[model samples]
Target: MKQITILVPDGQSTLSSVACIVGAYEVLMSANAYWKDVGRDEPFNIILAGVSKKAAFDNGLLTVKTQANIADISQTHLIIIPSLIRDFQEATKGNKLLRDWIAQQYQNGAELASMCTGTFMLASAGLLDGKNCATHWSAADTFRNLFPKVKLQPEKLITDENGIYTNGGGYSFLNLMIYLVEKYYDRQTAIYCSKIFQIEIDRQSQSAFTIFTGQKLHGDEMVQQAQAYIESQLHEKISVEDLSARFAVGRRNFDRRFIKATGNTPLEYTQRVKIESAKKALETTRKNINEVMYEVGYADIKAFREVFRKITGMSPLEYRAKYNKEAIV
Candidate 1:
């Protein structure tokens, strides 16, 4: 049987961490039970291993006693890192020993998977230096700032690269668990677990769930002014050339600085701002799709729909039908 070690992170969000750890455990155990029900034997031995014997959360309201200490477990088939909901810098600092162990285990041939912001710990351990990774969309800017080397794919529901796996934020980790079930067991077992969990299988993107508020914390005064200008001029079709001239910077220089500060080109940033405005209007108003598009400064319906779908992974009508009950009616 393959032994799976789910780390009980030292500084974790109580509910999120518990849900991820317990959810993964239940799903994998369910898979095992399904195998036993058939002619096959169980395929996994799951363990909750931690650097310490116990970890507390929510002001000591709850405590989890781990099954094994990482110091005692030299090798495992897989290691699961649950979300760290505390201050990421502090959480990563407090769990240095755990991070080191994870790095060592990866070197020893154990595959790694992180749920939500748990990817922070993996990145801290230098495990994702040049690999592709996905985390909660809200943390994309911060993740990019902290680990510039890791290709942050905030839009992806799950990212699998060279044995390491990561998933987007919140309960989307359930999708990652399903992906793992398919990998470790078989497709049939994965389908069975998905049915029992009621989680949609083969979920590929979290783009529609992302709220693009723009990355403003990069400490660039000029870029900040440009972003404010973009947000304030939503009704106007703003051009990068005009913006560059208004900011008194060359177009090429403006684009370079904007990308460095916001992780997006100026044009991409403008489109995102426009599309985000359209999304809000679609969700909260009775406006038709063309009306919303024109209100957001897109005169061409095809161009607006294409940009909306490119950024959001859904057409305007589809997004509205899914998010707005009134629209469905």
Candidate 2:
């Protein structure tokens, strides 16, 4: 029999877009059912561990009950930390009781796991030092700034360091679960579960695609609209006023609210979108420097080059020239 425990924070937001408010738990449960259906001969048990009932449901983010305290974290093969608090202050100011439980479990040989922003909780517990880890890429800078001891591999779908396993953001939790099944049972079992869940089974590896972070804003319709606008106009020169009008909010209000909801200002978020877009162009097309820049909405080559260098540590030409696989092959 294999037992797993999930640690959900108290007062956590139940909003589907907030940290820890995701559908990953449902996905994992479905995978477990498939595993059992395929006669994988393993008893998979999941326990929802939390602090207090009020803490667990303070924000309606979690629909589960608070379990017996951290002392109940006994004999589990895997302990999962799902999405964590986004604010660094909140993450660092962790629950002393929960942190101790995580540390004790890991020291006693429990395989630790994290999904999306959940890596922050693991890092806060000092579990990721000197280990390669992945998180939602949007928090790449913040994570690096806060946890300098941890090695940040921003491009991975999942990273296995020591006995701990962590996946990047989005549905990558499924990727981790599938990987676990294959490792513990066999490839056949994993593939059978994949088909049962109707997931694409032809993936050679999840790493081929960028790991998506699962951070989302709940009730911030303005942020959502601004995000949509940013995506559609990645090639346009967008200002705060443009974003404000798109969301129909005043500029000042939009700026403040966007930052509060998304942890990034409109300009900062737009740069990230551009950099990501530039990365795609570099990987999939043979477009030249100017063409790629223009495609991602940089009319001024010098400024675009500077921004790319600052964000990615490489100029457009340099990044494309250096990492293009075909060029190397």
Candidate 3:
């Protein structure tokens, strides 16, 4: 059986904390289910080992552990950290013993993994240097501010180099687990687990920003309706006059309220929304660049390309290629 160990830390995020514990089970159980259906041996013997009993700090019913000594961690193929405290103080302050243990483990050649803020722990352990890692967007600034030595990508759901694996925010622990299942088993088995978990496996190439947030162009209900109407009518020419008329507001009032709510003018918001849509289509679909441009209501391919590169820092083709190479599967 493959030994998988998850280091539960103190003050872990509630979502990530639950994911690390429950998510690990979902991965192992799903893998076992798949194996039995296909007549293969179960491949995982997972453990939720605390670095120490006192290594953990309890918040209400939530208990976060400090790092444990490597000798207690046992022979494990993988070490997972779901999430860590909000600040580095929680990591470094409450857990000196835990930090030392993590350092020793990395030197011993174990595959290190993290989800969300847990990347902070791995970074603190010094395993993230020279490796690309991801974390929650909210924590993106903090991670960068704390660990300048590590390369942090805020947009990716997961990143892997050599044996170190890190993921951005959300239920990506499930994605990471699916990745592990496939690595040990096969694509078929991974697909089976994904179905069992009701996950969107095809969303492998999807980015952190697009997957988490949606196009909400307007903040107020009235402006939202107008913006929704505008998005639906993207193929047709739209104008501020049309928006004012449709929303039953004066042109000046509409413009001011729209900007106040969305931080952008109506036309600007429309372009941004379209560009976002185009980006999603480019990354997730097999459609050609021209097709994506048209799909997002851009009749001018050159203008779309320029705007896309400016907004997303990459052209449609480059975005697609980058994510296509990333294994969402």
> What lDDT score belongs to each candidate, Candidate 1 first?
0.91, 0.69, 0.69
* Alpha-carbon shift of residue 198 in model 1 (angstroms): 0.3
Q: What TM-score, to 2 decimals, does candidate 3 have?
A: 0.62
Clashing pairs in 3: 9-65, 10-64, 51-68, 55-66, 56-65, 67-98, 204-328
The window of 10 residues in a row where model 3 has the poorest summed lDDT is 206-215
Alpha carbon RMSD to native, model 1:
1.1
Candidate achieving higher TM-score, 1 or 3: 1
Candidate 2 lDDT score at position 149 = 86
| Per-residue C-alpha lDDT of model 2 across residues 133-243, encoded as one tens digit per residue | 988776776787677789877766678878888877666666676776676556776787677666554332333344233225345776877787787887888898877
Model 1 lDDT tens row, 169-212: 79988999999999999999999999998999999999999999
What would the TM-scores of all predictions be? 0.98, 0.60, 0.62
Q: Which residue pairs does candidate 2 place in steric collision?
A: 10-55, 11-55, 13-61, 14-60, 14-61, 17-216, 169-212, 169-213, 235-297
| Residue 224, model 1, lDDT | 99
- Using TM-score, give the best candidate's number: 1
RMSD of each: 1.1, 11.5, 11.5
| Stretches of candidate 1 exceeding 4 Å from the true structure | none
Better of 1 and 2 by lDDT: 1
